[model samples]
Target: MSGRGRKIVWGLVLAFISFYAFLEHDVRGRFAARQSVEPAVIVPNKALAPVMAMGFHNLWADFSLLNAQVFFANPEYRGRIEKGMIFREMIELATTLDPSYKVAYFFGHFALSSYWNNWGVRQANEILKLGWKNNFDDYRFPQYIGFNYYLNSENKNEIVKWFRIALRYPEAPRRLIWTIDRMLRGADTTNHIHAESMCAMCEDAKEKEQKRYFCERCETYTALIALNDLRLAYLRDKGRPIGSLGDLTAAGYIDKIPVCPNGCNWLFTADGAITSSSLAESSTDVRGVP
Candidate 1:
């Protein structure tokens, strides 16, 4: 071809490339905006998911797991807890697609239970029950069920039932076994159970940093137990609840309000109950305490 003809062809090619790139960018931007405005929907029935995955079920499960993790980690989701959101559905779909995916079961229970309200606890229990049924040999599932029961339910009978199930598995952690024994004997408080679980998690930590972090959590929970005990004693003696940590200090409950090892302040609820910001499950309101 002649030089002018070649130059003209090259200019045409560049223009096409630029136009394609601009179109792609615009399409991506619009899609992202739509996603941001409209929250994710829950997956349909679990039975249909594997068929929809088209033989790449594990890959689809992994994608669902990733989406769940990101959704639970999002601050907006954490704050809102909106109904019909994909939080529970994604985890359920992931586990349904790959029942043997232990990480999905574990993370689903943890994230759901961390919501620390009745609805969240019920959802967490459902996930843990599925985990227990599917992964029977793995004691963590039943153990988490027992723990959630202890935390949220006043039904001692149900607590004992799940704890017995967990203890039947020899692979159950030593701390869990101990907690169960304590609960059975009426020697453990909720704080003690929380501390024991934290200590158990600390023992399982492979990294020095993780172990240290869990150890700190153990200390904080323990301290909160002591502070709560003091509050109870004050109520017994004065016939009224202590108003705040400052009240405890002024009344000689302690030299001062004990500092939380987690660096979050102990919060006083509307009922004058003391709780740490770090322990979401410890709220009296969520536990249905009068």
Candidate 2:
């Protein structure tokens, strides 16, 4: 081609590229703005999610899991206990898309149940029950069911029932039998149980970080129990509620308020109850203690 013709073609090409870039940027900006304004919603129907995945179901499942994490991490979603957060639906879709996704089941149970004062415990239980159904040979699901029941529902019978089922599994964590024994022996509280169950869980932890977490949790629970006992004594002696951890020190209940190993301060509830700030609302160590 002639130089003039080639220059003209090059100019047109540049113009087209610039226009395409501008259009793409505008479209992306509008899409982002729309996403920011729209409420987070999930397709609740599990059966439809696979169809939506269009043969990339596992990738879709992974996307759902990541999306759930993002949704939970959003600052706007924090401290909001109301339903329709789509956490449950996202997890449900994930597990439906890939039934063998063990992490999804575990994360779904932990996140939902621990999120808002056991508000999602029932939902977590549903996920766990599905996990149990799909992964029957794995004992963790039944064990989780027992723990959730014990911590959230305070249903002794259900706790025992699920624990027994867990124990029956060959792959059950060794802590299951200990938990059953403790529960049967009337060691309903941490004081009576001696943190053995917690320690067992810590020992059973496979990852170094998980082991550290469980050990720290055990220490925190033990500290909470001791603090609770002191608070009870103060209540009995003074005939009033303990206002704060300092009150325990001021009243000569102890030399000083014990520090939580988790680095969170102990919380003194208005009802004269002592709890750990680090523990979740559905934690067995936090619940049913005075």
Which is the leading candidate under lDDT? 1
Task: Report the poorest 10 consecutive residues by lDDT, candidate 2.
Answer: 281-290
Clashes of each: 0, 0
Candidate 1 colliding pairs: none
Full-model lDDT for every candidate: 0.68, 0.67
Per-residue accuracy of model 2 over 114-219 as CA lDDT, tens digit each: 7755666767788999988988788889888887876675555676567656755656655555455444334353342435555555666665655676577668
**Residue 40 lDDT in candidate 1:** 30
- The Cα error of candidate 1 at residue 209, in Å, is 32
TM-score of 2: 0.51
How much RMSD separates candidate 1 from the native structure?
14.5
| Candidate 1 residue runs with Cα over 4 Å from true position | 1-45, 83-85, 181-290
List TM-score per model, in order: 0.51, 0.51
Instruction: Name the runs in model 2 displaced over 4 angstroms.
Output: 1-38, 42-45, 83-85, 180-290
Error of 1 at 44 (Å): 4.9
